[model samples]
Target: MIDYRKATVPVWTLATGDVRVPALAGDGPMTAERLAELRSVLAALADEPIATLEVHPLPEKLDSGRGIPLDAASPLAQHLSQLITQSARSSSTAAKATAAGEGLYRMVVPAKVAAQLGQGIVRPMAAKGAAGGIRGAFVNSTTGRIAAGATFVPAGQAAAAGAVGGAGATAGVAVGGSAALTVAAPLVLMAIAVGMSAHADSKRQQAIEHITELLEQLHEQKLEDEHSELDGCRDAIDKATAILLDQGKLGVSLGLDSAVHAINTALGAADRRLARWQSALDKLPDGEAVEIGTLTKSFPGVDDHGGTFRTHLELAALAIALKRRVNVLQAVEHAQSDPGNLFESFVRALKRDQQRLDELESSIAGVLERLSALELARPNGLRPVFTTGEVDRLMSAAHRIRKLGDGVSANSRTTDLAIEIARDKDGSVVVFPALPASA
Candidate 1:
């Protein structure tokens, strides 16, 4: 067992022809040259028990009985300075070791004594004794004060020990060796997993393209079907209009009003469907490309060999325009039910409805022109192309229908005397005039 009180003071003794200083006591600050002198003097006095010296006040006389100047510039100071310079060089080397991931054991010392020491010092013998099991060193830079605990090791040494074992077996192992391989395996596997996930995402994007193409095809087909249905309805209105006009000219009437109403109703239905198709077309995703030829070919009953059917289609389109005019006239009559501000509302509604009908009529004319051009481009042997005159006839008929609608619109504006009489307050009580006198 060690005595704690004995460890606290800086007293050196000689034994076995060598000087031994207490590790804890010498750990205090002292000049390198002074420490070396003390060690040399003690070494010369081997086996001698030296008195405990007070380091605070230097003596006026020494072992040689000569006055020794303690001033930093004196000869004695110069000798101390050389020893201090050597100690400083040694301390610098130790500091470098510490800086290179080495641990430090700080030994606190008084500042004034450290200045007189001329150099920082670490007693190797004291460091070895104080560090029981931990590896470290004792550092001193003072002459009069006691030092504290000094054992230390590199800060990373403990963590390195945990990596291997408490025995520190793997501390010297290189980073890229088998030990590193064990850590890298999981990271490599994780990278491969991420790459495969990215590939799968790319495939999903491709599939989306395929699905969008399919949707586009379906939408085009729906449009063709709607166009065909509208064509058929237009044809029916044309036949009815022709029959009614003939009946009216013959004074037969043939309930022409009802036939006109039927034609108008059919045209209204077609207009509503066209509006719906336009809405759906507008809603399609932007930049969606479709094959124009595929869309035209998808129409049922489109003859590839003769192409004569296209002219019939053109005529059908013209009929739809005429039917639309009839519908507008009927709409104006219906709006006449509200006689209040009737003229103002009627004129506005008529102009708007007439504009829409004109636009549809223009579209019909454009389609007819395209069909005619397509026919002209074909070989002459294809069934005789419908005469341009037939298209002109259809247009003339549409113009007549428009004129008839305009006439009906004008008639609706004229206030009926019967209506005026019916609206009179005393209309129910008809008063008979006095009997006329005979001449």
Candidate 2:
């Protein structure tokens, strides 16, 4: 449940003459000026394809007892409370919910789009259509015009229809009279308000604060996702390296002498890149850009300009690239012959790693496509800024690695490696490699 304010404005009134409500003025506690300001905000949201809305309460700031209160008896409020309770149960969610404002509003896009949009980029387009009709009704309801039962679309229904096309609505209600409008589906109105609220400078700052927290959450998530793959790659390298050395001790020279060297060289580059990324992250300013209420340490050491963050991001991507290259070296000697147990394991691991890399590559491409769409949607002067160089590099690297992974064939001759030390028909360094005949 949230603390509240009651609206002094008219709730339901007939429209008079040519006067039409501007569609953002829900009959809550919001003012006319705020509604007008929000119209501009919604206009900008024309291109944002928002998928969902997540509501978060600011319990610390709720002590002021301000803002329109959700109807506790309503299903919408109950559902929200349930979600908040669920979120509180999650340690990860609790760590990420550093919002110090009255409420933290979030646009939950599809997971694929979240890769870039969640990174504190420019505000998403406000739901302009969602705010339509509702505010116009509010303004007209006050003008004392009688249009003889010309029904004003209830605020909740109007918002739902305009915003999400009524996909998530559980029920609709109309509050009649001069008092505050008791919305049935408060979530719709809440989202509409949050969308429009960001145009103001102060609200925009709060949105950024919430976005910063989201960015940190993303960083943590990315690291967690990559941890297993990274460890697995390193273990595979160690295991394969030891195998090569043991083979040499037994005087079995399968022309794999260069494999270990290649693996080490590839790994060294990955380590250096990771080290540089960490150094860059450490060098960024740790101070809060602006303090809201008592929360001061939001987004510690996060690069607002996205340079260092991109470096952090690309390391994981680059790790995948490095792993793919290293796996090629593992495909030597018996890999194409009578596949020994060790070679079989390497092949399986390589296949699995390749599958994972393909998945990641697809996700990255999705992000890039969305970013490109965002660029094309906005005018040149209003384009959102991004450190796309790292992203582009990662994409290119992934493409090359994926191609190499595809080229690695179990059918390739034992004399040659499929992914490394081989050339394609065009004389490119890509065909299966032949193992040394001495083995």
Candidate 3:
């Protein structure tokens, strides 16, 4: 198991002579007020890409030298095709050419059910798909891949000339488009930076940026730890799709009296995540352009450069202490959209995009896991203080979409998906025997 608990988010400073030094949170764990300040930042992170001030982690390359850069056009082509298919669905020539893989795909439900769902009236656990609303938007209408994301460094260890952190560093491990930085004697470096930031000269935005950076850092760290779990998830999706396709090849009854748009639309997106995850896993061998595991956490204590700076920063202590002062921000995200129809809202917004929600869900779970680790490893320990209720609100908000709870309720959506194709004539669902274990 990857030890997600071992790493921390890197904090840095803009040092003298235009150079960068790893920074520590000068303030203590975020207070409720400070946490409140993160409302907008959290919302932005959930929806947008990292706000990197500069090109910090300089891109590296392939050892074989016959590599396709991940950010290049080749990777994007798959995504482009998905978009074109949607608009051209009405043309039967296009539909006939590719019954399974091409044209506008949809999930056909009864008009009554569609109306009920459109009215925010889904059955229990239907909320699982709702979380996919914003995340779904991140999908490439063409490729259906997720563009979800994550950062670090240490002391004494020197860094690359243009590394994303201060001077001392180690080679970064890339995960998708993002990367991580490592450094020497983290304790010493963090202490020096934290106190320096407290001198009453820092702007509020800097603090906000600090938390945003931590969120990104946490995201990358999770990818490092859960790569295998993610890969397995992707593989499962592929197997399921294969089965569905195998059945499709035998020409099961297809002409149902239903709204073609709804059925195809949902089906088109149902397994998009499968493709998205596969695409990301495919890049694992090429950990360049981005790095992972470089985020170095700090405290008010000691490290390599010298004795502990002003204080001891650790699981017991922290950077900003968020107090949930910005609890309202999370609501801002949902409120800005449809008032009641969360599921319908998500489907409409995401119909054109590729897969991305799973990544975002992973990110929130990663942070929560880290926090839980801290609580477990050292009860009453001084962990990074989120004074604001950002984490709290964030946790609550994340949970809203991240899960629908344990057992059958959580799996109802998946069950419904299976029933979509395999229901029996008696009106009750049928259970197909498992495909060969080798499959």
Candidate 4:
């Protein structure tokens, strides 16, 4: 749905294979490249069992067509601001980065490690009394360790390090493909990689199935997008796709305006369907009493037992959506919840998931809502960028994917598409920027 040619990509971190450039610590505002460097530097310091967070400080009243300046205003910014102030004061040394080093990253670790490092900092490292306003800083929570920042600064390098410190408060900001306005730090990128790697070994077979189905569906939709029933619809989808890609926050969204709403509706359907399964279980003599493992063990001639077993399989298939929502939650918390507890923990997770869903729905809805509210106050070219038909396509694609049912759906299909996606977990059938021919 997007035009990759017109959009810019957010600066990739070293870990994500960011392009290396000569140190331009000063002589410029904090452009995308400088942020890439600072992100890379912090990543190397504590790559494992540690989380790195990039901090970007924006100028007053700056707006990009893409949603960056707003994304920077997330709670993450406030957290980073406080953490940096604390770290700058507590540590004798921090990064020698100037304002150009505005992309400085902070490493997260256990509290004890941070204490050992003594007020580890993640701010622009001007001298203690060096000139310039603070770019940004983040203090560690008592538990999340703030390490590596202080160590990067040496005994007498603050002034040189702080050279670009003045530019740290730079107002010039631009986003790359799909970066819209979320936290585009390498730390979050690394987290996505690490989180995906954490799927259960037991679910490997399921993951394979899901990935296969996802690839097929994505391929089909890509073809559809390339050849929409209406040229107007296709063009709108392309622009919307660009917005999603350029925003870079949400990945592989179905190019539908009401896409999020449809997803929520499906989640609601799945929940209700799960309730039916629960009702069926109550009819069985040993249904609720049975553990998760024996869900398939049928009793002699109990004709109805087969239905219960099928329900088990149904829940197993729908697990991908459940897994995805949970993963997003984990990323935000910066902690992993027990995987084994997915079903058992689902009840506990229900409220939290609903709350999270509401917030997401609101955020996404706000974009459209504001666009509607303003009537003509469109900024960053978002007005013509979104379209109702695209919303329809996004919703349609999501529905088609659901019909191919992962966990639970009313539609039943006999093809491999059904079996494959219903059992897989690698990802959902939705494609963000649309998949490649090979995928």
Leading candidate by TM-score: 4
RMSD of each: 50.3, 28.5, 28.8, 23.8
- C-alpha lDDT values of all predictions: 0.27, 0.29, 0.22, 0.27
Candidate 3 residue-wise lDDT, 140-221, digit = tens: 3333332212111211111213221221222122122111111111111111111111110121123333334443434444
**Predicted candidate 1 versus true structure: per-residue lDDT over 1-439, tens digit per residue:** 2222233222211111112333322333334335434444432332321111111111122121111112233221222122222222434433333232211111121222111111111111111234311111121223212223322211110111111111111212123211211111111111111111222222223333333343344445543443444334433433433332112121223343554454455456545544543454345344543222322332322223113233233333333444433443333343334333322333344445445544554443443333222211122345676578655644543343233222111111111000000001111111111000000
TM-score of each: 0.20, 0.21, 0.16, 0.25
Please identify which of the two predictions, 2 or 3, would achieve the higher TM-score against the true structure. 2
| Cα misplacement distance, residue 114 of candidate 2 (Å) | 31
Poorly placed runs, candidate 2 (over 4 Å): 1-308, 329-349, 375-439
Q: Please say which candidate is ahead in lDDT: 2 or 4.
A: 2
What C-alpha lDDT, on a 0 to 100 scale, does residue 313 get in candidate 2? 38
Q: Could you give candidate 2's per-residue lDDT for residues 1-439 as a string of tens digits?
A: 2221221211211110112223444434344344324433432332222222222332232211112222343322343333333333432333233223123333222222222211111122122254211211111233422122222221222211111212122321123322112122223222222222111222223333443444455566544443333433443443443443222221224333344344344345545544553454345445422221111122222223233333333443444444444443343323322222332333344454455444544444443332222211111335566368745644543343233223122221222000101111221111111111111
Ranked by lDDT, the better of candidates 3 and 4 is 4
Which regions in candidate 4 have their CA more than 4 angstroms from the true location? 1-208, 211-254, 286-439
Deviation (Å) of 260 in candidate 4: 2.9
Candidate maximizing lDDT: 2
Provide the clash count, candidate 3: 88
Q: Model 1: runs farther than 4 Å from truth? A: 1-322, 325-328, 331-335, 338-342, 374-439
- What's the CA error at residue 25 for candidate 1, in Å? 99
